[model samples]
Target: MKTIAINQYGSAEEFKEIEMAKPQPKSDEVLVEIHAFSINPMDIAGRAGMLGSPFTDNWSFPLVLGWDFSGVVVEVGSDVEGYAKGDKVFGSASSSHSSDNGTYGEYIAVDNTELTHIPDGLTFDQAAALPIAGVTAYYGMKHNLDLQAGQKIFVAGGAGGVGLFAVQIAKAFGAYVATTSSENHRQLLEDLGVDEVIDYHKVSAVDVLHDFDAVFDTVGDVDTGLKVLKSDGKLATIATQPTEEQKHDQQKQVAFQFTYGTGADLDALAELVLNGKLKLMVETMPFSAENVIKAHQTIEGHHTTGKIVIHVKD
Candidate 1:
């Protein structure tokens, strides 16, 4: 099998193409023939040795570093249930590192419980893009912030991967969503159902929007997030966290954490995709060595308006 890995952490420029033996599924895993995957900022963060979690902490070079995937099951574990050969599956990997396992390869052995069936009508590219960003946005709104209908909400970095999904999910739940993006992304966010769009480069979100309800901060702007919240509002940040004292003094639901991907969370993302309730704009790139390098370069620029899909195979 062929895979792309980083022998040393620095930039996506370090990705090395290597050939390795295909892995067999364990008793609780499935061998998936990967069809597609998404390029996310986390990928860059991991490649740069910036992640604080186990995903990147203490990781050595020549590591396989990918997470979200959409693929077909070629084989299944003996203990797995409700799944079989030739099942179309798509979901996020429960664990990631260089040597452990990753999605940036021709095949992957993922725990059965960690994946969900792809919706009948969705394409591989669409399914591949859903896991990381979709679930993060879904879980952030549904579980972390407990966003309610008719409430006003703000999504910082709303043009980025997770923010694109966050805006759509918030609208599906009947919330009035305000997102921060540059002028380039205004139309895109509007089409995705964002009620208000703030230009983060020119105007600070805190200065312009007096928020009620929740603020989903994909950007590292917890300080500004606190400034814009109402007394009862919550702030959920995927970036740096606030101190315990800050949370206490704010007197709101302030949480700083990453999305712990679960079966239920992945299902919610699929349900939204299957029902025509959620819409995502994606740019697909061929999964070649050249394209992979280019994808990393584009991601590093941090101005992409939607998910970047790596078309791995059929």
Candidate 2:
């Protein structure tokens, strides 16, 4: 199997394509032949050696850095049920810090609990784009925010990977959604049912928006998010945590959310996709070291309109 990995963390230039032995499934795992994978902000952070502590502290050199993948199950573990060889599947990798279990390769041995079948109408690229970003948005809106129908919510960085999903999921839940993005993405987001689009470059959301039921901050701008939020509103951020002083100054509920993959959540997202409630906007790239570097650079710019996916097979 061939994998793009980093022997030492630094820049996107650190990516190198290398050959490694294929993995066999454990009793509760499945061996997947990866077809596609998507780039996320965490991949950049992992490549830059920012992922710390229990996640990557013990990971060895030549660590593979990816989490979202869609592929075909080539082999199933003895204890695994409801999945078989040749099943099309997609899911996020459960271990955040493991050198041996990343999706930036031809194969990955993943726990069965994290794997779910891709529905009939979905492609591998779209499925791969959904796991991390979709699950994060789903969990943040459904769990962290407890957003109710007819409520108002604002999403920062509405053009981002998670932000795109957040806006659609909010609309799916019947909430009146407003988000901040550049002029280029305004029409696209409006097509996805976003009620309001605020241009971040020309104006500030704090100046015009107020009294929101919830705020979903995908960018690290928690201060601006707090200013636009209602006194009793909840704010959920995946980008960064609010400082203690910031938290003390505002009595609103705030949480830093980290999403883990589960088959049930993936199934729910798949249902939304099948029902035409959720849509993915992805830019596909071929699998190569150069393209990986390019994708990292594009995502690091923090202005990408949608997910960037790498076609690993085919």
Candidate 1 ranges beyond 4 A from true positions? 56-61, 97-100
lDDT of 1: 0.83
Q: All predictions: root-mean-square deviation over Cα?
A: 1.8, 1.7
For model 1, residues 5-72, the per-residue Cα lDDT tens digits are: 77878877888787766767789888899999988888888778877766755356567778889999
Point out the worst 10-residue segment of candidate 1 by lDDT: 92-101
Model 2 lDDT at residue 46: 87
Best by lDDT: 2
Clashing pairs in 1: 7-62, 63-98, 64-98
Cα lDDT of model 2 by residue, 38-131, tens digit: 9988899888988887668647887888989999999988998899999999998765536867888999988865679999999999899988
Evaluate all candidate structures by whole-model CA lDDT and list the values in order.
Answer: 0.83, 0.88
Clashing pairs in 2: none
What are the models' TM-scores?
Answer: 0.94, 0.94
